[model samples]
Target: MFESPNELNIARKEHKHLSFSAGIYYCLGGQAAKLEIEVAFNCLCDKFKQPRLQEEPVWRKNSNMHGMEMLMIAI
Candidate 1:
């Protein structure tokens, strides 16, 4: 048997909620706003069946908006 010269991390993980900075970050209507957005996304997903990406998304290549840049989808 031989050893491999590569990397394998089994602990590190990432997601949308993990993007925010630490501490009690708050806003006047932040909770409401997030609920609204999540509801909207859920509604869209319910309406669209198997909505898939047409191509590789161009997300935050170089822009102020860290959100989705170009999400080419086909319902």
Candidate 2:
């Protein structure tokens, strides 16, 4: 943000991008997605040791859709 008429904001500590956009383009599923991701990470950390990729991931052709077709993880 700029300081045209007010304050220019900056992070005082750590920073991370969540990608929860604003206005009409904002992701309506952002909260749910964040919750799911947190739960999944917790589960993985609790149940597994150091996880690693076992093979190259396969992806779909849909440009708007971002995900893996098959992910093989070795702990």
Candidate 3:
């Protein structure tokens, strides 16, 4: 709700271009999504002892998405 108009416009454009966009419905429930992600990450870290990175990740190219293609975790 506090976001600027320009930021929201950019987001709307990006969402339109993306194939997997979840739309404003997700934004309306962003708090719930953030909480779930936090809980899962915390639980995983707590349960895994001495969890370390095993390898460098190679990101996917020529794509609009910017997430890790491969994340090697040594647990």
The candidate that achieves the highest TM-score relative to the unseen native structure: 2
Clashing pairs in 3: none
Tens-digit per-residue lDDT, 1-75, candidate 3? 334422212124332332335666336656676588679768878999876668765566645665566767789
lDDT of 2 by residue, 1-75 (tens): 323312222222433433576779878998898799779967876898876667766665666764567767788
What shift in Å separates residue 28 of candidate 1 from its native position after superposition? 5.3
lDDT of 1 by residue, 1-75 (tens): 213212122133432342343457635566687689779868878999876667766656554435556768688
Better of 1 and 2 by lDDT: 2
Which regions in candidate 2 have their CA more than 4 angstroms from the true location?
Answer: 1-22
For every model shown, what is its TM-score relative to the native structure?
0.51, 0.60, 0.50
| lDDT, each prediction | 0.55, 0.62, 0.56
Query: What would you estimate as the lDDT of candidate 3?
Result: 0.56
Which candidate gets the maximum lDDT versus the true structure?
2
